[model samples]
Target: MPREHPLLPIVSLPFRRAGRDPMTCRYRCANSCAHPEPNASSTPYFGEILERSLSRRGVARAGALGLLVVGTAASTAGPAAAAPAAPPSGTTSTSGGRPGRPLPFEAVPPNTIDAVVTPPGYQHAVVVKWGDPILPGAPEWDLHRQTAEAQEQQFGYNNDYLAMLPLGTGGRRALLVGNHEYANPELMFPGYTGIPDAAQTAVMFASAGMFVVEIEQVERTGQWRLVRSGQRPYNRRITTTNTVFELTGPAAGSALLRTAADPAGRWVRGTQANCSGGVTPWGTVLSGEENFHFAFVGADEAPESMKPALRRYGFDTANRGGPSAELIDERFDLARHPHEANRFGWIVEVDPFDRASVPRKHTALGRFKHEGAATVISRGGHAVVYSGDDERFEYIYKFVSQGRMDRAKSRAARQRNMTLLASGTLYVAAFDATSAAEIDGSGTLPADGAFNGRGRWIPLASDTTSFVPGMTVAEVLVNTRLAADAVGATKMDRPEDIEPSPVTGKVYCALTNNSRRGADANPPADEVNPRNANRHGHIVEIAEDRGDHTATTFVWSVPVVCGDPQDPSTYFSGYDKSAVSPISCPDNLTFDSTGNLWIATDSAYALGGNDGLFAMPLAGPETGHVKQFLSVPVGAECCGPVISSDGRSCFVAVQHPGEITNSTVENPGSRWPDGDFGKPGIVVTWRPDGRRIGA
Candidate 1:
């Protein structure tokens, strides 16, 4: 096999425990791993509660298999049967595997190759990339001479979330919306040690936000190309330099959210650290603002009343100076404007169809380092959203709209449905384990032979109502972590992305690695997060009671405890472990039309290779059989991971390619898509024969 970058040398550097290189840790999340875990509250870990509950209930190991409703058919009994053959038309299944089809393509083997390695018969290509011109009148990208103006007009940097919505029939054209998570100047500049002036810092800020570009599907093929030279009216750029977002919900105009720039507390200048996101049922996009705390300064001088909330969100309350963004935008100066930090860290909703529409930050979602917001309408017609706070020992949250969705296909209906997120009841998750006595922080199966249990969604706030004592509705939404801590929400191991299977209505959460688990002063592993010093994170499957997304109660299971197949601690939903590809640090997740779970990884160095995308069937005999479909180049984290509506194409954002400690643009680590200097971008893969992606 030919190497992706046979001429370029692959530099090996020491990485932090999060599996991210030091440079990625610094720029992407402000070296969050280096700081002490922010969740110091005494809320019992999920595993501890599970253990105590089971002790009182007594052991009932036999017939427990009857309770597992995951992908198994009720009539079949025992394990799920093999999926039936695909129909002659070869369309993908959208109902979460009610009529499941078999996985077709053979799995790709793991390797350290510096390229976008795909399965046989599949082809991949770079779509819009960093510095690519999306807006008209934007100058071509120059590697050496980057200007703040040009960066604002061009594609933003380090694209994370991706959403492709069809514009016409047969998927001929669509709008491709991407989230620019953050910027790495060391990889962008020729010799960047640090920002020397405001101009350079402005360029970095302009490169961090979101971009919407129109793309056309290649005639008679599964691939799609960017619409560069046409009447692309939707092509737009949103950056920290100029884009202003509206603050909505109960806390929008509260005194705690007000700042000098916006006395009404209803508007914010921009968004940064826009990580993984989801495409809403109404065709809008929801982007998570993860790690936004890193951009601010003067937290130490902030008022004593706000210090605890700020510190709980990972704001460095000890820091006193040196925030380059404060030079251009005074909002970064938290001491002068302490409430400005509250203006950020909310779930941002954007309309991809309306370029002129102002994006909104929904305070009802309950602010935190949101990993992503995936929505699934409840059986009752209300919109149900699931989000995870992306930090060690944080909690998972859910929001149920007070109003039902207007299903009519009109601009007014869309606008009305968009307001659903603005008024909702926010709830945090509290899990109860069944086999607590069997769990010993060894990642081992319990006496019942499964890591499964019951859980409930603990309500925190609704409109102007607060459920927690001594906190108002505004305090509950803005200072959510403290409220959850007070209410005894279960602590999770860095829950990143929570997505519901459109087919089964079963929610899957990607629990990224937590190195502090079982360490001194930290909680130990439980059934849901069943690993001590967890390097290879696990995936949790949640089934709301009676298959209702609006239900407060649920049953949960850990189907995939990720790691090398050879490791005894690993499990893949009872499938033959030897046949599964090694996966670690599961990050962003999506579903192909066939209801197969598609996972994009970050910090997969635990598996001794580059991070890539993997597909796993949720139903049939192949359930829990993990297979690698594609791998990004060296030093890049696989993100976005939007599968086309037809399931013919898989799009992933290859972020921070060639990023390594002490390597500047002139001397990079990996030359990926271009085989030149490293530039983060989006890549799409599909079979040349036009078959459904990953079979």
Candidate 2:
């Protein structure tokens, strides 16, 4: 259940005839919802403990804090964009993290112990991990009594958001998939058990979820691995306690998704807490069920128009004792099951190359906590996704898809572009301030001098209609954050991982920091999250409209506020923030086929320790320059950075390696690619002569 799933069905879909559709694209927010704080994973997902519990929403420009942003990725490409690949013999994107430098190596530095470092001619490996095997007659990992049928054919646990694809095009083999995102119980339960029977809770429900396998490309030096010897049939794994999902758009079989074993809300079994994902031009793999309210518990027995979105998406209603907060099943006790936590925060997708097909959950892309799903295809080939709801203030979404992307690679064009994410239309963004009354909170640059502006999107449901008014369209896709808080939207900051910009379709999000936006947040410092307690987290950018990747309206800004450029807030676009490379919170992003944006960081110990992977150069002169090529150890969190379409490998994942707090599994804090405990795998990184990691 990587990124869980929902939606109902539709099929005959070949880019179904649609109309203008393509609005919403930001997480929900108007009133409450977004907490973060408590760390050392009891389940917080997303890193540096969500940037030291949401980086204090900082910017308001305290003292001429700096920011003039302008845009461009290959750092001012001059040749109508992405058209300058001729340098090979040695290399050069320019310097390290600013103007013209697509991370020309040399930054790195942040450390902790236990490792996976990089940079300095790059080289990383590990590929297939956690229990390994993955399909083809299973068995192998036997960390003691582990057997949910041998952790369902192996390789699951931690590894977050990845993709790969390839398969044909002589790229040497691909598929890979990934996104296990949860499961560490003292290193996959060995003697470190608080009390777990029922077959070690069914091998901790088969180590959380999502797998796929298939790798290859070994001898090329961009190194891959796994393709385990033979048969392979696409390799599978699903998880959360087996697997079964459907729930398409307009709220599938709504009744808030009937549960007593699928009372027919379309079907739902498990999908674990998958985090981060996306990859679908016409080859499925969306995933996003981020921090699924740590599995269900629904306090206040919901129903009061769904009790303010089940207490603003932080469920787990009572039953709060210990044993690592157990609640095995009672449908996660939401007073005996309250809409199975509305059948999980969705955006599933999956198809990798159809192992046996069937895997959806679209709900027109509403239900929050999604934090992943990138797409971007419209020149009429419809598709356009892009999500982010990794808690705190939530609200950023997008879903277009009324089918349409048959760039034929057949298999009925990958089963009609995998039903283009079930059905579409489901916006949500608002930002309109050139200086909303001169944003106060102070972090400062709004005399129209630019915090940038104009944003729209709105919608709320459409695949069958219900522009949110009084609900229904399955309560606006199962309470999509109270239908973007009854239509006001806006609130962002903790957005986390948005994408789109293979070569400037310009989306790039990662607001990843928002220690409550001050004025006592609930609705504070707007101007599209102008920062108040916002520590170090920024990078907005948008663009849309004429570059219409669906477009409802846009023109955003922010170009990297992230921190440490001698702390006068930090901006990067006007370049010279001492030449970029401090970064913080930014979270996952991708984009290099030439648009260069990489980035990873989920917490930045001020500018010292772990959490790394940065690149930036969205187009010439290092657009909002960033640099650090790779870091990741002492309690990891760099998550699937993907990048490999001949760009020469890059992968990532490494989540929760040696997760922290009391260590465990025999005193382990992080052993990295290996040493012991703390699993979470997949690394890759390349450029050992093959070139192109940061070159």
Best by TM-score: 1
Clashing pairs in 1: 50-433, 95-503, 96-503
Task: Output the lDDT of residue 30, model 2.
Answer: 14
Task: Score residue 268 of candidate 2 by CA lDDT.
Answer: 81
Q: Can you write out model 2's per-residue Cα lDDT over 417-500, one digit (the tens) per residue?
A: 667677878888765654565566565665545566556798888877798777778888877877776776666767887866
C-alpha lDDT score of every prediction, in listed order: 0.80, 0.64
TM, every model:
0.94, 0.33
Q: After superposition, how far is residue 171 of candidate 1 from its true place, in Å?
A: 2.2
- Tens digits of per-residue lDDT, candidate 1, 598-646, equal 7889998766788999988766788888999898887899997877656
